[model samples]
Target: MFFKSSKINEFRLWGLLFTLFGMGLMILGTSGIVFWGQAGKWFAGVFMVIGMIAMLLSVGVYFWAGMLSTSAVILICPECNRHTKILGKTDRCMYCKTKLTLDPNEATDLDEGITEKA
Candidate 1:
């Protein structure tokens, strides 16, 4: 069977995961409030703190992903001639299983090719 790929899949997955995490954190924070009324001070405080940390992390992840989406380089795959965005130190061609590079001079370094392994 042939496999088809979609653009923005990774970013969308990250976004969905982060959003779910944020929602979960909000639920936990609400639980913490309820616990504060029942459980002793220390436990409730800990729960609230942990929930807040989760929320902050989720937000940071979402913001960072947004920045990455904007900054990621778009490339037309030489193998398939399909357009795709490359992110970070490495990425993959969404259409073809061909290795790609962000820097032509550093192309020899498989490790340095931003789209070497994708």
Candidate 2:
């Protein structure tokens, strides 16, 4: 299976990517600046629509990531034995894919959750 980072880290990385994508779109939309008046408005309008969409999406992603962070639980990775944070009911080791458990009743390898292990 492909390696995956902890849920929290993935969210953060996604948020950063969304922000950059929005900024890039906004920059591209401003290409009309060179033409000054004639074509600027038309180009700016077309670019602005797409750019605004990207920026709004980025803002939403950032907000969601921030909200998700509030519930993240800090734990020690079993494989690497290093301290790391994981989100949701299931998660994997930040450094290594060793299974972890929050509840004593449940088995170490949870069938469903965010991460595969601690």
Candidate 3:
């Protein structure tokens, strides 16, 4: 609840984290030359490979998120009146973080006390 985010946004956030981590690794790899002279080439190569793998994984995550976004149901949030996308039966508003659900049963349950408002 403290870190609520729409499913799509969560995916994007993870992708971004992966990208940043990969870039960091690549930079660290390149810096190996400054630390170990000629021997650093092997260390750099290994880190660079790992970095590339992370970058590729990020690309895949982004692609998956994009595909999911295309199919997500867009709805207007009752609390903020802003448009938000819902990925499943339950999700939070992208802007207001209001608890949302497509199921009527869940709605009542949320209304009882579990719902989160902006």
Candidate 4:
């Protein structure tokens, strides 16, 4: 399953990855001091700035996901019979990982793809 998650979960996952990446970059920047002594100050500053940008991007993504979640349509997954939110015309059951879609054409397409892969 390349992307077998609800849209909201996917967004949050990406946000988390961005946060981790940003933190790693910041830690790497601080480590410059250990490797280059006084000259590392410039190196640290550059990386720290880049890290901050990544962190900000993550924040934006989180905010956007949050907003989308609030506006998303809530439905019960036929497979799982559990509540899940649909972000766009298509999404998946968060629990059962069933491909779900509001459009009939998309649903058939998804089914055909699944059958082909299986």
Task: Name the best candidate (by lDDT).
Answer: 3
On TM-score, the stronger of 1 and 4 is 4
Candidate 1, 1-118: lDDT as tens digits: 1222333445555556766766675566567557566554556566566666666776776677677778778989777888877765455676675555576654665455767666
Cand. 4 TM to true fold: 0.85
- The number of the candidate with the highest TM-score is 3
Ranking of predictions according to TM-score:
3, 4, 2, 1
- Deviation from truth (RMSD, Å), model 2: 6.7
The C-alpha lDDT values of all candidates are 0.62, 0.71, 0.90, 0.89
How many residue pairs clash in all the candidates, one count each? 1, 7, 0, 0
In candidate 3 the C-alpha lDDT for residue 35 amounts to 96
Candidate 1 pairs with clashing backbones: 92-118
- How would you encode candidate 2's per-residue C-alpha lDDT over 37-110 as one tens digit per residue? 67687787877778777778778887887787776788887678798777655677767766565766655444
- Ten residues in sequence with the least summed lDDT for candidate 1: 1-10
**Better by lDDT, candidate 4 or 2:** 4
What lDDT does model 3 reach?
0.90
- The alpha-carbon root-mean-square deviation between model 4 and the true structure, to one decimal in Å, is 4.3
* Cα lDDT of model 4 by residue, 29-93, tens digit: 99998899999999999999999999999999999999999999999998889999998898888
Clashing pairs in 4: none
Off by over 4 Å in 2: 1-3, 35-37, 95-118
TM-score of each: 0.49, 0.66, 0.89, 0.85
Residue-wise C-alpha lDDT for candidate 3, range 1-118, written one tens digit per residue: 3369888888999999999999999999989988999999998999899999999999999999999999999999998999999998999998988889999878855464655662
Backbone clashes, candidate 3:
0
